[model samples]
Target: MPPLVKLVLIVVIVIAAVVIWGRVMGRRDPDREIVGLTDAVRAKVSREISAGHKINAIKIYREATGAPLADAKRAVDHWFVPGQGPGVRDAAASYTAGRLTDEGRARISELILAGRREDAMALYAEATGAGSAEAQAIIRTWDTSQHY
Candidate 1:
């Protein structure tokens, strides 16, 4: 075999091995590793969820620990259950109150700015616990000056 061909084959093999290893590791219980995360990190994750970025929160968790999407999602979901953590409690309160956190509002604003009114309305509905009609009304009459 040519030297260049052998080099390429070796690189490919190494890459494949790394990918397989990552997949195997990512399938393990991510919660066990993430459970002891500091309050600050948990707070950030909570804020991301409250802001209607649950997937992003999961991605953040995964990036922090290279966990699989499923595992990361499971960990983040656990963070929302009552008694899991103080940050979770605050996030739950904000969610139950039908209030949008600053991050949520900003995301909505971005959607609006991008001419994505429907997406913004959907996000508002999810974040504020509003029905379809109510969500439309709120979006139409949204007062940026008022606290959400």
Candidate 2:
């Protein structure tokens, strides 16, 4: 076989191995991701909560674990104790749960109309602290006709 052919065959094998590995790793295992959360992420979540940015906290948690907003909220609500660090306080409990409000959806639509789907998803996730999957769902279901 020619050198070029050997190179092509090697590339194909590498790509196939990567795809197979990704598929096997993509299987749902909520506990697996959560358990893998680094202490730095936990500390950041704690700091965000203390700063009265509960939505941000959930966003960080969701990004780190791919967990749903509800799970992230619950984890933040239960894990960190107040007064141990910056922005920690009892008032953190008063923060509302993350959800894409009507206004948020509208803003995302506007972003999409601007041909910024990635920005739209990022803004939606930041504003609502939704998981990546949920944010994608919102983008997928957006009524494009409304943009016209």
Using TM-score, give the best candidate's number: 1
What's the true lDDT of residue 96 in model 1?
58
Model 1 agreement with the true structure over 33-94: per-residue lDDT tens digits: 55445444555666677687898888777766666787888888876532233322332444
lDDT of 2 by residue, 29-122 (tens): 5555554466467656766866778889888887788776667789877754444434322312222443545576678778877889888878
User: Could you tell me every candidate's TM-score relative to the true structure?
Assistant: 0.35, 0.33
Error of 1 at 143 (Å): 27
The C-alpha lDDT values of all candidates are 0.65, 0.64
| Clash tally, candidates in order | 0, 1
lDDT of 1: 0.65
In model 1, what lDDT does residue 53 have? 89
